[model samples]
Target: MPTETPRPMRRQILTFAVVGVINTATYYGFYLLFLIALPYLGAHVLAFLLSMTGSFFLNARFTYRTRPTWRKFLLFPLTNAANFLITTAGVYVIVGVLHHGSRFAPLGASMAAIPVTFVVSRWIMVPKAGTA
Candidate 1:
């Protein structure tokens, strides 16, 4: 039997919202640890990479529910790269440039990237693979 395509755009957004929450937690956990362990920039970079992998795996399996493909595998890194830039930039501007270390800045900056990353990861980077 043929496979059904993934859900419509609204469903996609909702699915992404759920996954985004999980990914945000994963990213923040590592971010705080690395922020203390390493240099601010270094920690952000390393933690972002680690969390990106985790998010990709979870997003592939749970959020999008698409088949694994060589294309998706390769594109994951690119998607992460985009996410990293946005995340890192946000972190730096808030923590470094703006010096908004008001306790909220850390979480706020990290949270800021969720929507940006989700849109790219879902619509552009991760291939649908004709669903599962």
Candidate 2:
């Protein structure tokens, strides 16, 4: 268990959304920067890693109101991997395989992955009270 006290689920959800907004901003900021500064795939990977770090810290401390622990920390990267694969596969299916890389295509596909990532990240990356 970590030092931080846990908040209620509703408050936790709100906090999670707030942190998500910040993390999304960070992800996109880095994404746009990477597009301008780095090459293809490099930009996406770099931004994804950086933004994931932000999400882990924010969600752990603020959203879930839990202290950092080895289990939680270790689980963070794995949750990120889940998010990355889900996001990538979604984007690829829409943009690459489906040939629907237009305005609504990416949005439609990405919508499928967001809730899944949130649920998994919430359950996996945050510590529960009185657990091992």
* lDDT of every model, 2 decimals: 0.69, 0.69
Residue range 11-119, candidate 1, lDDT tens digits:
7678777877777777677867877868777766776777777777777777777776667766777656666676677877887888777334546666656666766
How does residue 106 of candidate 2 score in lDDT? 28
Query: lDDT of candidate 2?
Result: 0.69
Per-residue CA lDDT of candidate 2, range 20-65, in tens? 7787778767867877767534666797789888788888888776
Scored by lDDT, model 1 comes in at 0.69
Model 2 off-target regions past 4 Å? 1-7, 97-109, 126-132
Where does the lowest 10-residue lDDT sum fall in candidate 2? 101-110
What does candidate 2 score on TM? 0.73
Q: Going through the candidates in order, what is the number of backbone clashes in each? A: 0, 0
